[model samples]
Target: MTTDILIEHRRDIADLKQRIKNRRLQVLGLFGTPIVLAVVLLVWAGLKISFWLHSDTPSAINNILGGVVAFLVLSVIVQLVAEFSEDFDVWRDRKTSVRELNLQLSLAEERHILEARRRTPPSMDRQASYKERLPGEIARLRYESQHYRRVHLLMQWLLFVSSSAISAVTAWYDPPQPAKGVLIGLGFTVTVITAAAGYFKPRERAFNLQQTADSIEQHATALELGIAPYNAMEEASNLELFATTVEGLRADQRMREQQLDQPQQGQQHVI
Candidate 1:
């Protein structure tokens, strides 16, 4: 049975690996599309300005400047879209991985329970020992999840700051007339806000992921240590509880993926 369980786990892991790879490719495509579009638009805008450059009037120069600014703005929007798509893909992959890991652990635990039940009465204490190991496994998973979240958050913040600086420099170099400046400023402000929100949004998710992992670890530890409620439960009941916990985690993970995929109000592509 343990061998069978291990085989199943390996299959599941392989499936997850494939899924993640597919998602990554999809995300690359999503980001790539806007960059291609931006390049095309940029070329078109450049040609338009080149044609306008022949005229010597201030109005002609302003028209060229306006066209250039518009292209820049569109480029920023494309980049934001790409960023959002990448984030969504990453979040979904992480959530799915976590869910699958939890499920695997649960299945392993169930296998242990089954083996213990088949043992002679004198060997029941060995089952308890097996259970004791569960807490450590859970704790390790929680730590890993926390680290992943921290790294992801840091990357996002860096992207936001870099984008904002670029926008600021662009604004300064091309200081527009008062009216135009106001419009450009508004657009810049919107971009900054979106980036800021995107940077911070993952922190909450990180915390939640950590908390859930911790909870599972604690529950497993309690069960193993013959503590309180878990200690009182029969083998069947304990198995049921473990199954339920895994199911809940899976559901939560799916929900998170859906939420991450949902379009945000100010979502924009920056490419």
Candidate 2:
């Protein structure tokens, strides 16, 4: 199915869900008044019974109680009748809507499955698969590397500036109690940020990721242009060498990641 159809189905599902929710709320409201009135009627009846047994009660009060009980009883009966009259139709329509929503959800899932299968690389044609996947892989790695690099740089700058500010504030200004407290808090912040930066090693991660991406791109380019290691061999052999080289680079990158994740005694370096 086309993406548009899947999107439309999703929209339909959402609309149906909202309709169902509104209908349920409406049904609750439709029945709620009668229940409340019934409770009121019961309370009034008890009051009426108590007043009837008392000889000192006023007749006017008895009349008012009788009128209120009658009104509550009538209101409850009317509300129940009206609600029951519409309940069956409302429930039937909601049920139909729910079924349609389920069907639409199923169709949307099927569309997603089909899209995934369409994008799956062929197992038999290794070269074709590589061509289909390498560019995207390279782009993703480069993007992540750049993201890490930017974060690392920002954290480093923040640490430097915060440290300098804390130093200047302490040495030059005695200031107020609140200002001193802020400086202390800033010092704590700097320490935490520095520790976190050291632990995460974003610089090392960025370097390794960028190197791997660049190495993969280089191999791909050489294979495409028929040069160096790829230039002297048959197409299949060249493809094999290219795949092995790329895989090795990826493995090395993974190893580096594992090393970074592990706590070391001293400073960690990218292997």
Candidate 3:
């Protein structure tokens, strides 16, 4: 039973991590393309600035260079449609629901085991019960830690791409009135999106979840191997102590999870 639970959790984590890896590559390409073009624009600006400083440059050559600059600015819009699509929202939501179910199940089983132990003819099943749920908790935490780590990075890149694109477009060229208006609109859009991503605080949440997971793994590993701290005395004593430790960690984790879930009170996350 423990083996099966471990395998299922491991499988789910592996699947989620692979999907995150794939999405990271796709997003990096999408965002990187704009930065690459922006670099090209900066280089173009450098040349323009260099020529502007050189009074020895011929007028006709300078005129040709000006034409090149305008053409490049117009070309940026073509590259903006570097179209790629991934249904991240759908997959992330589904995985979140699965994880939440696992959490609820873990908590429920824990309560059931407690109630059983308190009965008149107390069942000697606490150890067995804890052993059953430990694998799932560990698996879920591992997945969540790594998942949030990916989300933090993806948002950072997105913020970079949008901000860099805005700077490159407005700073490097003087567009026509309508195009300049679009430039301002683009700046506002980037600001809003970047703000939204940052307001979620994915980086801090990722770190917190990762730390909690590592702490839980300490208990999980000890319980699994019957090691010291948890290995003292009889089997009942060991399992009872293990359950206490697990409950503490579970409470801490649930509080952290609750904090992460509080979207209305400014716990919003892009991932």
All candidates: TM-score? 0.37, 0.55, 0.48
Q: What are the per-model C-alpha RMSD values against the true structure? A: 16.3, 12.1, 18.0
Put down candidate 3 lDDT per residue, 133-212, tens digits, no spaces.
Answer: 77787778778878877887877786677678777877776787766886788777678767766567677677776777
Query: Any runs in candidate 3 off by more than 4 Å, and if so which?
Result: 1-123, 260-271
Residue 126 C-alpha lDDT in model 1: 42
Please provide, for model 2 over 1-271, each residue's C-alpha lDDT reduced to its tens digit, 9 standing for 90 to 100: 4546556756765766676676566556556756766676676667667765565556776677678767767765664555466544534343234456557566766765676566544543656567669999999999999999999999999999999989888887886887798798889989988998989999999999999999999989998899998896567778778888888899988898888888884226443
Candidate 1 lDDT, 165-257, residue by residue in tens: 656656676755664565566567657656655655666566666777777766676666767556655775665565566557746765664
Lowest summed lDDT across 10 adjacent residues in model 1 is found at: 262-271
lDDT of each: 0.60, 0.75, 0.65
Runs in model 2 lying further than 4 Å from the true structure: 1-124, 265-271
Candidate 3, lDDT over the whole model = 0.65
Better-scoring candidate (TM-score), 1 or 3: 3
Global lDDT of model 1? 0.60
